[model samples]
Target: MTTWKDFLVSASTDAEAQFDRLKNRLFSRLDAKKPYKIVYYRGFGSPTAVWITGRVLRERDLSTPSDNDTFWQNLLATYQRFESDEVPGVTVRVDAFGKSNTAVTDKEGYFEMTINPPDNLPPGRAWFPVRYSLDAIVQPTGEPVIKDGYLMISPLYSQFGIISDIDDTVLVTGATSLLQTARLTFLGNAYTRLPFAGVAAFYRALQSGPVTTLFNPIYFVSSSPWNLYDLLIDFFRIQGIPKGPILLRDLSFSPAILSSQSHHTHKLAMIRKVLDVNPQLPFVLIGDSGQQDPEIYTQVVRENPGRIRAIYIRDVSEDRRDEDVRELIRTAEAFDVPMLLVPDTVEAAEHAASLGLIDPDTIPEIRADRRADKE
Candidate 1:
């Protein structure tokens, strides 16, 4: 049953794709002699197969920012991020565990593939390096470009997994308001962008779980564009957030902007994929009430049933949205998953400790960190 809205979205999506193809063709012709690089996003997998995503783009002069960087420098870096020179139709080869796979970049210069190893990987949580090499024909004037991308393989049996959102959930992007979001994004560097109070401590505790060595995997699934990948990675490092596979969406000119429901489609699919790959592992879902996270996470609980351990939504919106999420909490409770809308990380930490998801002794550390972050 395709509604009128669906038909309109489909037609607009096609038009946007065609426009992107034309634009990419022109850029490819104009930037033939430019230096290029392969930018890899962190990937995740189990013992049998690995999933990876990356992009090939003409290199820009964006450098690491210092604390004293001028406003102009931040603005320029932001511009370079959005002014991407994507290289389409280039062949990329990925090799790991004595096996190899190949994929071609799409018009948006992005490539994704899943490769199964010849044999099962050793059972444990660790990072594997996947070597990526570009076809020489694309860069005929110089040596072939090669880079290593990392894939995190979680243990077959663990306490649980965590899937979280980025923008307003952990990092403060003021996502509910376009003007504030733009102000923060355009003028702020990794050092300047702020994460919610005590997010680092809370996420670290979750990663370590009740036992410090558990190494429960954490995944970030966000609706943010792929262009901000490097900035987000740097921000995570600066804030001491646990690292894992970051699932982001392409910044294509799609009809997604016109429909609120389309924003969470990518996020939901990515969360489901993570759950599907780790069938034996239950998960904790985390997001915020600023957008459609409550609605999306409720759907996840309904679909996965026993697979979801709990849900924690950070409260960042108004009373109306709070009530909306409260109703969603009731809806999720029907599936036996405890869903809480917390005003801060402390509340979530308390509930998680009560549930034995994290160690109770870590509560003091969380409080100290939260207080220090406010300074």
Candidate 2:
């Protein structure tokens, strides 16, 4: 059942991996030896299972962001992120929940693994910390690289989960416009980039849910490349947005990349993975209408009936796209999932409040934050 497109994609992936191998070998001989590090990404799961992901790369001496950073400095830092030297074919290990599991980095130096949840984890606690280290040694070896990665664990008694998009939904990337997107991607750092007005308060409210202690886990599923993962994490930290596992796509170049299905494929796969891990959790999906969020979310609702409590699609597209989103809203409604096209975070918060998904008292805080962001 393999088509020509599939063949091309496989061929391109193999070719890219081969090229990376050769490049890594050549660089190792020419450049000075550098220490390797394991950059553990945040993970999430329920009480029975947990998922973790991270990358292994040569430690680069990039400049950290500062409040008074210059444009050139930000641009330089952004450039360095994309130019990261990945250490492929390296084994990674995670020791958590009284279990040990190992995985190897692929051509892109990324590794993902699923491990069992802690045996005696408390019921009310949300975050679980685990130790991860390099299982196998590779290149300029020094001391062993061991780091701690935290996973967001949802309690069985918690409220609905929040699955959100990053670029347009939370951060203002101007994703619909290529020029603006490129400008921000290249010239912007964590300090320079801006989140949408009231996004912080609204997301916090969703994380808090109806009950203050519910602590519903929020997962950020974005179509952005993994190279910008650190940058996005910095943005979340700075904007006071709730922190959770950020599932992002690999920056791969293939014949399939030319097709629009790539975005849908990546986003859908991540969302489904999240839903699968937390089987008992119902979710509220939040995204923007700039691209394929509406369509993809509709598919999610259709496939996982009753699992999605509601959906909020922020209006970031032209008037023409309005009808498309409205159609999706109707489609989602057929499954009893309330999908709303919101003008801003306030409206979405209002809708969530009415649904009892979030605290009604948080509306005033969202409005205040919106005004402050505008000013």
Candidate 3:
């Protein structure tokens, strides 16, 4: 049952080992420092359980620690190889919701553990109080990183789920423009990074309805690598956006078969993984016309018919593709899926309201957020 990802992990582990040996031979003086940091990604699960993923690595950038964790610097560092070495063969323990799961980190220092509770927990957004610590016997230090991991369990009987792209649809990554994308990447911090106008309010309305308890799951799927996971989490909070699982690719510049897949392939796999996790929950796919979102979402609509509740495509005003997007619109129309080639967040929100997907009153919140951006 070996998978392509597993093969890639194995290959990457070998390459990392070779790099470490070479480093040790040249810089033996640097070996005195102990490894004591962990990079954990928030995970999601159902009402009765949750799953968490993380990598155990030493704090390599201890010289320039920031008040905000300096994720922007780490994000920039991801472009280089061997930024942080993985502590493999480490015994990691994860405890949450009165349950515990133990697993060993692979050669990549990555571990995933799922914890199931005794009963179904409360609906809406909830954190299971996750705590992880490396086994002292194998660790160089006893320090443990404490962070709250989020798991959004959609109301068992709620409406459709949402899996949207982040680059241009939610935040202005300028992904379609090379110069703009590089500038934003190197120059912008998470706090300064901008979300598209009204996107936050629209997403919030979708999560918490007019009655204010609707908890349909909303997921942010992006081509951005895992290095920016924390930054995106901060971006969601500062912008008043509804919180959900952020699934990102592992854009590790390594020799791996899994890395060979196009960005769209990675996204499609993640979307399908979400669908498999929530079998009964139909989805509303959202993305932009910036890149392959239109085409990728079209394939989803075709492959998984009737399960798609709707589709929303935010048009890139800079590179507005009428003919290309129109072709996608026609494709969605043929399948009877409600699709929109929207110019902005306000228009998308209004269209969703008209379709009874959200309350008509949600438009103001979206507009207010847009206005705040201008101010």
Candidate 4:
């Protein structure tokens, strides 16, 4: 009699067109008794998507192939619709890979694959490489999708983390100017957002690290509207940022009251909450110089100075000649935390590695990749 593991091996294949059919057939053979959780992440205008299906292993006699076979089948079925959503007039193909399997996304930008690594597969790490592409189209709204035509499925770590901003930081479009700030506060989502370049890369790199590392937990605290919570999550997912709790400003509180607090008072309050909940983990804070990052980080250093090992600030314009920059320098000086000013993410990563915050061995490789792209 063929074992369940043998059936799973036989079921693994590379035909993207047959992914759905194969998944369905395999799942139908399962008993459907095991509980599974379906997790998914998608990015806008990018051909990247992530999904994981797994059932919690309880102490049960799974020695029989039938017992475990059904579980695998059910897990595979859950991932079959990876790219089935229709993006009008555009066809997307998702390329998916497992240790022993490969597949592609359908016209609707979906793909499915089964991951059944050998039992000896390292217990602490799980990675999947996925890629896809689609024709570029300008939506009626005039938003253009740039197709770079590069397909790469990197080793996505099973563990991930995130640290984000608020106000114009993660929500809305303006953070530095007073007029735009008023608009973002009063109108909310109507203000729109222009995410910083290389933000997606930063998040993906953090996600690719080992789950048990000090920086694996992703964290975001912003003064933006809490109503945009789901939208932000989807944005990060589609962009390949790891998923984590987003701490947002409670609009229910009076704006006047909030203003009375320090510039970073609200963000600092939220950061404290994050530390309270996750006491031992270190965090990489992502923010812009326009608003309260420097101020909040200053306070964070004073309070739990050890928790934040790296802070990345995008150097947008500010009255640095004035007291703002001086104050930030003073705060960082007090903590002995090296504050780096960078035009983009690549520079930030380089600085971090140089400071021994991240692995130094990886910097040359990342720099080379940057050069290749530019050439």
Report how far off residue 247 is in candidate 4 (Å): 1.0
User: Positional deviation of 338 in candidate 3, in angstroms?
Assistant: 1.1
lDDT of 1 by residue, 281-317 (tens): 8999999999989999999988888988889999999
Model 3, span 7-97: residue lDDT tens: 8777787776687668645543665465456677767766654557887765553333233646556455434223565667777777776
lDDT score, candidate 2, position 95: 85
Q: Give the Cα-based TM-score of candidate 4 against the true structure.
A: 0.49
- Pairs of residues clashing in candidate 3: none
Residue pairs with clashing backbones, model 1? none
Per-residue lDDT tens digits of candidate 4, residues 60-174? 1212112233444433322332222122223333344333233433332323333332334333432434343333433334443222211112222322224677444434356
Off by over 4 Å in 3: 1-17, 20-31, 60-82, 123-125, 137-141, 144-148, 254-260, 317-320
Return whichever of 1 and 2 wins on TM-score.
2
lDDT of 2: 0.87
In Å, residue 243's CA in model 2 sits off its true spot by 0.7
Which candidate tops lDDT?
Answer: 2
TM-score of 3: 0.83
Residue range 1-375, candidate 2, lDDT tens digits: 999977878888788878877888887887647777678889888888888999988866667787798889988887878877887888898888777899999877899988887578888788877888887574465567788878888887877899999989999999999999999999888888888999999999988888765688899999888889889988899989989899987787665554668888989999999999889999999999999999999999999988999999999999999998999999999999999999899998999999998889999999999998788
In order, candidate lDDTs are 0.86, 0.87, 0.74, 0.47
Order of models, best lDDT first:
2, 1, 3, 4
